[model samples]
Target: MRKEKVHINIVVIGHVDSGKSTTTGHLIYKLGGIDKRVIERFEKEAAEMNKRSFKYAWVLDKLKAERERGITIDIALWKFETTKYYCTVIDAPGHRDFIKNMITGTSQADCAVLIIDSTTGGFEAGISKDGQTREHALLAFTLGVKQMICCCNKRVIERFEKEAAEMNKRSFKYAWVLDKLKAERERGITIDIALWKFETTKYYCTVIDAPGHRDFIKNMITGTSQADCAVLIIDSTTGGFEAGISKDGQTREHALLAFTLGVKQMICCCNKMDATTPKYSKARYDEIVKEVSSYLKKVGYNPDKIPFVPISGFEGDNMIERSTNLDWYKGPTLLEALDLIQEPKRPTDKPLRLPLQDVYKIGGIGTVPVGRVETGVLKPGMVVTFGPTGLTTEVKSVEMHHEALQEALPGDNVGFNVKNVAVKDLKRGFVASNSKEDPAKEAASFTSQVIIMNHPGQIGNGYAPVLDCHTSHIAVKFAEILTKIDRRSGKELEKEPKFLKNGDAGFVKMIPTKPMVVETFSEYPPLGRFAVRDMRQTVAVGVIKSVEKKDPTGAKVTKAAAKKK
Candidate 1:
């Protein structure tokens, strides 16, 4: 027997009503990890609340408003054990407004599954229409997901499935994912869930299913951030169909983005294979394979690199076991792909860093800080300081679930008690570190790199947004826009521009509303971080470029100095 349990943190995401909860329910049921009585109790509660279709999600939703809304509003966590591994699922909401909640969930996972709807497929429309595909893919790469697989679902709906396959077929035109669409095309709605997984060789595994909807794109982001591998579902009957493709268009940008997100391995499940008559025909399967192969090549991948299977989740075809109808298609079952996936290793060598995501005072326990340990070892009695705020605290104890531990390594979701800190002062985004270093104090004059985004009018020299930094947020205005540069290449552009574009990166001198904690990027990356946001969306994300050696503006007058003046 293995003495140590292999722990895997997994997050399930996709568009709303794309079977995220249903799939999770099935996994829990098959694993025999969750209590049947608990499920039964939820079923009863759901019935009382008039949520007749409620199942496993009801047990986790926890919020009354969410129960009434019939969608996950926040992240709900549950654990299960397999013969080979112990897994935890961080289920997140599939709506746009709940993106913050999704980020919270994704930041904790070792791997993710990108769930695609084989029925509807990847689309040029929906909330996912805009720059979401590129944004999602970029975020995944930035977070360092090593491997991935795509899980495509909803093959039962042939019309929707045809549209999805067509979308994949047409996404091949652009040099990069972003160049494929203009502003108008980006707003179109996506309806299917594109599922995939990512992982490292021996470190960790994650899966994310990109949902096809504007409303559910947030779920996709959350899922991708937490994934190690992915799965792409396909509707066998509609393979190679053209519903979402425009007559004038020719390219496959959607599938390319999935691959770019570091998904090397793939499990293509041709769902609802037995639904049609003239079933198990050689010509049909061959034709489907050829069309899919052609599309894969156009997107710069070899057919041999991916394993394609046939299954039905509802009828119990090839989900966990081999299917009888699709004897011609010989491939691993869905469960086989999941079982064969390796776990990703936790990075232990890096310095321990934990971002203060949430902090609350428990009734019995004192000030408890809740956050995922990003790196390093966190032990009890460890002296740590919070953010640029320089608030210091001593760890009194550490607890995971109900069990208390002396220390917690990386990937452990443990809450620890801290002394001499007010609950209100220890705000979110503050980083906790083992070494003793004073947090950066906000300077009256500091330099920053800014990107100008949405506003009613043009943003000129003096642009302002609320700067949200570690444990502190204050109004900050750019006193001057120094020079503009490309966000990606980091190359400086032409002469000074009055207003910055949506994604332009530029250096600027900033003036804060009040003295807050901040540090020069050279000294401390954590304290140097800042995000600029308006009332609606994030306008810019920047780091402290430099701090003025002397205050440029002598607005503050010292009482003792007034006599000398």
Candidate 2:
């Protein structure tokens, strides 16, 4: 028998206390993938804590501080196999400090599932930092995905299973937060981990989960970039208004970001109808759909084209199971929605380009350059050159994880034997590719589209931040601000911004401390990539636009081959 190979790499993300772990656990169990030993251990632990209902999902609480604080601190990876696919669930922390990790994770995902909570309803008091929700939106815009879904969780308190009752209970709660919401009052506990899938018609998906909460916001950003699609989760009862407004506001922000990032479609889930009045749930769902539709309209999307669904992840009602509770509601369930998502198009035939993620020494291997292969094929005996240092190497061998391979190409994770290159010779932010195909060299002047993050407090004309390009990190300063453009419309924001702010997206010229490989976005996206970082955090992301021409100094000599030709 063929080793039954179907893999779906997906992530879970959202505001904190939105039940990311719980939802993830539920999916594992619902799919019959959880081990009995793990469940028993969790039961024993829950018994000690006096919460019998706590299942194996608690095992996901890996960190001591996370368990105590009820928050995710790091991104966790788990695996489960279905009749149709083997899935890897990446659980990312919702905190702000972990945003870098989140970006890393998002860059690896193919699709995403965004979670929201019903208890707190929406953006709670003190739940954000410097308008982090807005930041999340901005980051999501960079993660060009196709499918976006939303889930509203935690209506379990009402105990109403009827669709009508859930609708009634949903409308009772409203006006929680919006512009007045701060970053302090947001709960850190996740009540459920919602799931959604985005599919494109072209390539298999790698999904991401961005859970809410200051702790896991990083996870959301990282997860989103890797995904080709995404989903939003909301609670049907308590989530009605919360999902419609505060939570809805955030959803719009994220959705808008996704749209800006090139996401083509999305699905919204109204979870937890089992514990709410059918009337409240229905009313809430209607209201939420209307609000989301109106927002989409304002943002240039047709209102009638929006997709929303209602379900309860906890009770397994309308999630993967067909609930007897809603015979009146005729539509596909959450699972069906997931199944319906089409995979994104794969630009595998595009030019060979690799984003240098890291350069490290591996014992006998000397120096190793690690990064995801964005396009084309990597083969042995092929001569490749990395950024600026312009070190040329012959591909002696290729290895991934540990397995040896003759050649690796797009989507393959492998390392090459770069002879004569030393640990000190190669650093992060350098790319290794066939020099014959790529232009890996320093440019004096280049246009770049940058999303400015946090810049240094003491600003100056020549202040430089550590630039993160693929795996290479070097000191780079903005040489000039050619023009500022609207992040959304690409319309000019300012002819020049002396100082770019937190959410600004504009084009500018930069100078690197050292000569490094840089290229125009049109020619080599891999070498064109870069990120800005202060000592504390990542400040921005960008791609080189074009290179400025320089004057030739050396005496020109005609090549013998050229003369002969």
Best-performing candidate as measured by lDDT: 2
- For candidate 1, lDDT tens digit of each residue in 1-565? 1134555555443333333343444444444534677656555554454332344444444444444445444444445554455555544333333333333344345443333323322222111212221222222222333332323332233333544532221111110010111211122111111111222222222222233223433333333333333333333333211211111100121222223222233344333344333443445444434544444443334455445444543344555566665566566555555545456565556556666545788887778986556557788867775544555557778875546876676655557888756688776555666644332233667888665533445566776676644324467878888888886677889556787766577888888866554566555443455445454233455668888533223232223223323
Off by over 4 Å in 1: 1-6, 47-50, 81-86, 121-128, 131-135, 155-347, 420-422, 435-482, 486-489, 502-565
Error of 1 at 58 (Å): 2.1
lDDT of 2 at 389: 56
lDDT (C-alpha, whole model) for all candidates: 0.43, 0.45
lDDT of 2 by residue, 1-565 (tens): 0135233444444434344455555555555545567666555544443333334335444443343334444334444443343344444333444443334333333444444333333322101222222233333334433454444444355334554422221211110000001111112222111122222222222233343444443333433333333444443444333432342233433433333333334444555544445432555455445544454444333334334556554555555666676555566665555555444344456656555544678775676775545567677766666555555666667764355766665544445666666667666445555667653555566778887645545333466876544334467778777777888798997886676776778887788777655666566443455555564344666767888734323312223212322
Best by TM-score: 2
Model 2 worst lDDT run, 10 consecutive residues? 172-181
Using all chains and alpha carbons, the TM-scores for the candidates as numbered come to 0.62, 0.65
- Count clashing residue pairs per candidate: 92, 119
Model 2 TM-score, all chains together: 0.65
Q: Could you tell me which 10 consecutive residues in candidate 1 have the lowest summed lDDT? A: 172-181
